[model samples]
Target: MSKVISRDGTIIEYDRTGDGPPIILVMGAFNDRSTGAPLAGQLEPDFTVINYDRRGKGESGDTLPYAIEREIEDLNALIAEVGGSAFVFGYSSGAVLALHAAVKGVPLSGLVLYDPPVEGYDGRLVHQLTELISAGRRGDAVEFFQSQLVGMPEQVVVQLRNAPFRPYLEAIAHTTVYDTKIVCEPPKQEELAGISVPVLVVAAEEMRDKFKQAAELLVSVLPKGQHLCLEGQSHHIVAPVLAPVVKKFLLS
Candidate 1:
């Protein structure tokens, strides 16, 4: 793992692999750098993949009073580290984060977003997530995010209580609040339209209506946006299926 210092002096940890144009991997909630490992492996042959632990999760350091701008600054530091401009690929809420960073003028050659869950959310979710995390209800916080944000069924959420990965989910529950703050509100059409960089919004064919709509909405507003739906895929991304499509769009 490599480390970089953000503008706020936070220690950001990331793994760099492969040897071509750089592509930073931004993960969604309940994830760390490890979440992108498979995709990195698949794309390593053609892209310099930087899979990083978002602040407050994995090996990355977090400063108190977290704000979205701090997260943006973290991306900026990584971008500067990788020759000042590169492709950025964001998954789920990470996609939303990438969009926020792009709108703020973080230099990027292009963007690739997969199933961004940016629709049908509101500020109340931010408040709810914050309260849960503040009260040390980490497990509940994790469950709430899975149930509400990820739209996991109630029965499925309960069934996962004994799942082996349950502990990992609770361990980084605090970061869910950060993600909620990043994506609670849907993107403004005017703001997204200003992002001049080419964008590829990848959606899953079997994904729910909200997700498909979210992908379509982004493509509709982005000045240079295009949409692609992966057949037989859902919110769960298969690296082999996705990496090739991503390579095609990014290289085009």
Candidate 2:
């Protein structure tokens, strides 16, 4: 693991591996660098994969009074650390952050977004998540998020409580609200239309209306962009299946 200091003086920890064009992986809410590991390893042979804990998760340091721009600044710092411009791939809410960084004029050769949960979510949900975290109900927060944001059914969320990663979800429950702040207001189409870098937007064919709308916004608005829908893939994508398509797009 390595560390980079952000413009705001926050410490961001990351793992850098392989040897080629660089790709930084941004995970969704409740996910840290480990969530990015499988995709990172798959791309490492052709890209210098930098998998990092977004601020407030894993080994990354957090600065109070969180704002989305601060998170964008974190990625900006990591980009500079990796050396100027490079490709960036973000999953779910992290994909929203990647778009925010690009639209805000961060340096990037291209972008790959995998099913960013971009939506105009209700404030009540965010408020509830905040209350849960504030009351030290991290497990409930995790279940609430999976059922709401990830669209996992109630039964599945109940079954998920037994999964080994449930603790990891609890461990990062504090960041769930941070993620809500990111996705509650997605970049307007006008903002997306201004991105000059090439973008590859991928979503599953079976994705719900909102997800499809979000993915379409990315492709339809970006000046240079393409869309791909995996036949059987969903938001919870299979890395081996995802890596090849990403490689083709990034290398194109």
Candidate 3:
């Protein structure tokens, strides 16, 4: 395990492995370095993978009064520790952070984003999620997020409850507000136009229509972006499968 101290003095912990171009893995809500371990394992052979615990989870520190800019600084601090610019891949809310950083002029080798939930596509679901959080039903918030954001079926949600991810899910359940803040507004093409690095926007074939729309928006707006749809997969199943695609795009 490696650690980098951010400008704000938060200790961001990460695992560094493999050999080749550095690929930083930014996990979505409810995931830390451990939860993203499998996807990182798949890409380790071809790329140097940096999987980390974002603020408030795992071995990282969290300061109150969270601002999205701090998360961007966290990524910047990690990239600096790894010797500067590298390929970046973000999933869900993490994708929003990556996109924001890229637009802010972070030097990225390339980028791969999977199923990011941006605003304006649907407002009712976001309102419901906020309601769940306000009610202090963290577990229910997680379930609602999976079903509403990722469009998971009730049966699939039940299956996930028994998976090893249950704890991680619970950890970020209380942080749904943070996710909502990041996704409150749809990403602007003008904001994305500044990203000059190659990009791959991956979407799940089985995800909700909104996810597909979001992916399309990213691809269309990014200056150098390509879109790829993963057949027979949803958000959870697509991460590992997309890891290789990311490796190919970044390493090529």
Best by TM-score: 1
Task: Report the lDDT of model 3 for residue 246.
Answer: 77
Worst 10 residues of 1 by lDDT: 208-217
User: After superposition on all CA atoms, what RMSD does each candidate show versus the true structure?
Assistant: 1.0, 1.5, 2.8
lDDT of 3 by residue, 1-252 (tens): 989998899999999999877889998777778767888889889888899999888889887677778888999998887789888988888888788888877778888888777644365666787688678787899888777665678999999988886877777775665666677754578888778899888887876576887777778878898988888877773456776787777777
TM per prediction? 0.97, 0.95, 0.85
The CA lDDT of each predicted structure is 0.90, 0.88, 0.80
* lDDT for 22 (candidate 1): 97
Clashing pairs for predicted structure model 2, backbone only: none
Cα deviation in Å at residue 159, candidate 2? 1.7
Name the best candidate (by lDDT): 1
| Error of model 1, residue 250, in angstroms | 0.6
| Superposed Cα deviation of residue 139, candidate 3 (Å) | 3.7
Name the lDDT value of residue 248 in candidate 2: 96
lDDT, model 1 = 0.90
Local accuracy of candidate 1 as per-residue lDDT tens digits, 35-103: 899999999999999999999999999998899999999999999999999899999989999999998
> Where does candidate 2 stray beyond 4 Å?
208-210
RMSD of 2: 1.5
lDDT of 2: 0.88
